[model samples]
Target: MRFQTITTDILVIGGGLAALKATHSASESGMEVLVVSKGTICSGSSFYPLMEALGCQAPTEDPEDNIRLLEEIRESSFQMHDEELTKIYIDEIRDRVAELPAMGIPYRKMQGGRIPCFAKRARDIFIWEDWNAIRNKSYALLKAKDNVRLMEHCTVIDTILHDDHIAGALCIDRQGSLFVISCRSMILATGGFGDLFEHNLNPSDVCGHGHILALDAGAKLVNMEFIQFIPGFMTPRYKVLFSEQILGYCTQVNDAEGRDLLARYLPSSITSRQCLDERSKHGPYTSSDISRYFDIAMMKEINDTGCEKGFNLSYDPKLLEDKREFISIYVDWIRKEQHIDLLGTKHTIAPLAQASNGGIVIDVRCATGVNGLYAAGEVAGSLHGADRHGGNASGSCLVFGHRSGAYASQWAKSCDRQAINTSIARKALTERFEHHRPNRIDADELIKEIRHLMWYHANVVRNERDLVYAKDRIRQLYEDFNPATHMSNPKTIGMAVKADHAARLSMILLECMLLRKESRGPHYREDYPEKNDRSYARRLMVQSTADKDIEYRFT
Candidate 1:
């Protein structure tokens, strides 16, 4: 196969809000910036709003309120976050959010002003009008810049290293053409691995490829076990995110067999009303509160019956009569945009993988402990701990996205462009495409197997036996699968590469889940039901050794 080489000062490997912010920051320095996306520009997790609008949280201008907000963040994360980074996030998020209005991003205004969605107090959140406005305006603004260029429908397979530092990246377009992206610096904003699960709300291309790329290039990952799972519609509209705000109004929840699923799994001590009330307080499932039983029951039901459709929920609007403020906005949006009437329809809901709370470990400046390599957005880890606040996902995209871009640009300007080594790219291509053996394994089937394994064994509820079995199964799949064998059909090469990365990442995530023996936040181990702060309080870091074996350490 032949290779085409493209040179740039900075290479950004995503098209989400974080990547756009990074590209915007880097372009201001007059450096040529190239953004490569797996889909169209501005299309990632950040642009896929589950509800009528997307919430971006920022501290209120009040000094005392900001202090309270900071404390709440630490409490919500269960002290799993870096205090330095938490402080930076609280101090800078307001200004970053304020800049959005100027870029043509409109905020949803209410009578009492911004309402706190997931927090008790002082956690001010600004909701964007919708995903379409944000994408169009952001795309138009970036396209107007001279130094910024965007390559859509392009997937970056791996990063190339020279003398233990990043030199460039390897990528493939939709047409099966190969390209070598040579750059002085590279930033990863590829989002998370929600797509690895059978049921997830993420885009198809977000399958933890960035995590694998970072690990392959000698960077450490932390909190791989702390994935956030939220309820999503499984019936009428599969994979659509279910609003947690409506959970409180649910009057009845039944399985496909028309049985009381929640009552069967929920302990007798916890009343159904109590459980539903607590569950409505947050979007993601967390063991930190009593609401965890709601998720546990749903998962147990799915596992017991092998019913992928989950449970049908019937709600009464009378329950939300007192919550006029919430109804006026959320319920109205549901009626107008989603075209679903909660009072008239019964919807099926299941626990769907939402976001990753852990990823590549980065410093305050967004450097991933590798020279010329930086990370931002959901792909960058440890800004959040076990559970993240409702809107902090978008907030982090703005803060770290800007930081990674500015810092990568500064680093690139101070250094000379690295020489390109075509041999490295050629060797990688040969190892992946030169095999003469017959292709026995299908990439599509392999991906399906991995997704099923993860959703059943490793998601939401985990135990030693299932996790160990999953780890071994993934390792076996990774060992047996070979993209080179399928080189005759070039269209399948990208899928093979994606499946390979998913298998490797699944192994690492299973290892992390096994290492943390205690249940904390979203990571619940049935065998070890209680949180053991003394034994497993610190963050766990995983990296690839020189021999290509996984090694982990506690910080």
Candidate 2:
């Protein structure tokens, strides 16, 4: 297949808030920036509705206090993050939040004039709106800059490397058009791999494509064992996320037996009602919170029931009746999405993989081990370690996006534009086209198989035996599955690529899980049962050697 080539100084491989911030910052440095996204701008996980308040941490007055808070947050990961990088992430958000108003983005303030801290004591800013305003305003500013260009509906398949440095990237658009983005530097802002799980909150397209790309290019990944599984709605068919606020008001009961399940996991001292009341103040599962046991109970129930059918969430109808405004807002969504009255009826709930706290290994400047390559946002790893606080996800995106952009721009400006790497581009393009050939395996079936295996073994509750079986199964699927068989349709091609990414990412994640022998934070190991700080406290790292053999280490 023929291909087109575009040259730029910096190539940004996402359209989320992090990518936009990077593009805008890079363009301001007088460098030409090109952004390529699988979907439309702001369509990544940034705008996903969480059914709870979403907060972004800004800078606080005291650096030591910020460090202490950040350290506490990283404790969820068992203190596996790089302290310097963590400092950069928590420090840079203050100025970034201050700059939001000038860009037409509003940060809500508390009545006492202090920023709200939803999940932690750190100052966090959030608004009633999801992310439409910030996304729109950021895109407008990017579009206004003459040097910044955006290519939507474009999926980057691979990163083209010249020796150790990034030379360019190969991408395919929705129209099945192939193109090459030749640049001096590349930033991987593609979000996490939540969609790798059978039930996830991320969009369908976020299947760890960036992880596979970086790994294939010999970049190291750390803390892959930590993925967050949050309580989510499944019944009423609305699948609306029931945030901590909503969970507090509901009673957890078995869907079929109508039995209270909290007693199975929580101590006798804490009643089910008390657990629900205490858990409502938190959003996701944090290792430090006593409510995490609630999540463990729900997940244990899910694990026992084969996870096909969800559990029951029953709330007092009078609660909604007391708050007519809340009911009025939800009634419309209930009718439109599920055609059922959610207040009076029992809804199904399950633990769904929501966000990943692990990703590509990067330094304090957000530069990966590979020269001229940078990772920002959720795509970059080692910041959150095992568990992520609620507001830190967006805050890290802005902090590192700004830092990575400036560093990448400086690196790009110092280098001379090299000739287009036609050989690498051609090889990558040919591999993509081969998927369309006849007599290949079905991508849909393979993807479904991968998701089921991951959700069963790699998520929430993981054991050594299950992880080993999953790793072998994923490897076998990767060996037997041929992408070319199901590539007749454009949509199938997309699914085929995502399936490929999911398989590779699963294998890597399994490797990380297997190496960490003790249970820590979100990387729970049923076999080990407890955290072993003596030997497993350090972060685990994995990389592809020149011979393609995987090497593992602890930093």
Candidate 3:
């Protein structure tokens, strides 16, 4: 069957804040834009706001303070960030935050001038009305644009390249129909790889396809080992994230044993109060924090004992007695959302994979090494070195989204149109349908196994032995994958593609993890417990070879 072909000046693959900003910027720059979203606009991880001091770092008049704050952020990333890119982001974040109101985000301002946010010492966090309200408004803005065309329920399978430049992309729409999107420039804003892990806070659709596409197109990816995990709800449905602030107020109890788990792991010298206080500061588990043992204990409990039920987090009712108003306003929302009371109740939670601290390598312009390809938001790497700062992820999305759109639009305007080789796209589609049998592997089963395998071996904690086993198992699964039975179903096909990408990315992540022999930020290893800056301080870079071999280089 001959597939339909659509042409556009710039093709943006994603529908979150980054993609929306990129689309808006590209359209505003007088370039026709086409947005292809796996899900609806603002429906990815960008929609899920973090409770722990989430806000952007806006620029200040004091240059000294800016430098100090940048140093702090670099410290947060474990000193692995691209200095030039960090400087550009630090300089432009305030401007991006300023533009939010115009784009329909109703940021609540406090009494003392600027909008108040939750942060440590720094005060740049701002509260918006809600995710739904902002999403509706942003969707309206994108729909209202005459130059931008939005396609929902579409996934890009392969980026068509001609002579090292992007010619177009092959996509699968909702109805299992394949089509070729011919574009002069492409922007990838497809979020992170949180969904690759079994216990993750991100939506299921974020299966690391952006990294896969970029790698296949001969682009480089960096720091794939550093994924951040935080304490989040495990049972009664995975709806909301357990806030980092809760560590201070709650008691950690092993649900099955009904005993304090931290007491067993932490030294006996420290009292329970001291341990809790230390655990409070290490909510997201930073390597720089001495309290990271709390996180390690949580993981060990689950991993060693097969405690899949996770831990029971409870707070003394007496603690909330004086702060009833604050409890009603803040704590009441979690109860209402989850339909479970907080105080005196053991809310089970474990380390949930939050975000990928690293991703596809990009420059200050959000341009990948590949000429016509640009990446923004979590899809693009080098912004966060070891660990990401609190509010920088959201801010980075807006900042680089604008840059990606502007730069890609300018490239589209200047570059000559490249002719696409239809045979390449045809071959991809043909290979996709090569197997069609009931004896083939189930897409759902494949995805489930990959998710569990990743969480078991390649998740928060890792060792060299487990990583090698995981690599072999993942490679075997990929080699034996059977997408034949569900090839005709678009949804299944999407899952198959993501599963394939997940397998490939898992190998890359394992390799990077094995090479980086130190416990730095989120990438922790039990074998190499110490941070060895003299040897493994630099970032690990990986690129695809001509024969599809992944080659690694540390700089």
Clashes of each: 0, 4, 3
Clashing pairs in 2: 59-94, 77-386, 435-484, 440-485
Q: Order of all candidates by lDDT, from best down to worst? A: 1, 3, 2
Which structure among the candidates has the greatest TM-score? Answer: 1
Ranked by TM-score, the better of candidates 1 and 2 is 1
Q: What is the lDDT of candidate 3?
A: 0.77
Full-model lDDT for every candidate: 0.83, 0.74, 0.77
List pairs with backbone clashes in candidate 1.
none
TM-scores for all predictions: 0.95, 0.89, 0.92
The TM-score that candidate 2 achieves is 0.89
Highest lDDT: which candidate? 1
Error of 1 at 495 (Å): 1.2
Q: Which ten residues in a row have the lowest lDDT in candidate 3?
A: 110-119
lDDT of 3 at 71: 71
lDDT score of residue 203 within candidate 1:
87
Task: Please list the residue runs of candidate 1 whose C-alpha ends up more than 4 Å from where it truly belongs after superposition.
Answer: 102-104, 108-118, 319-325, 431-439, 487-490
Q: Which stretches of candidate 3 lie over 4 Å from their true place?
A: 49-54, 59-62, 109-120, 318-329, 421-424, 431-440, 482-492
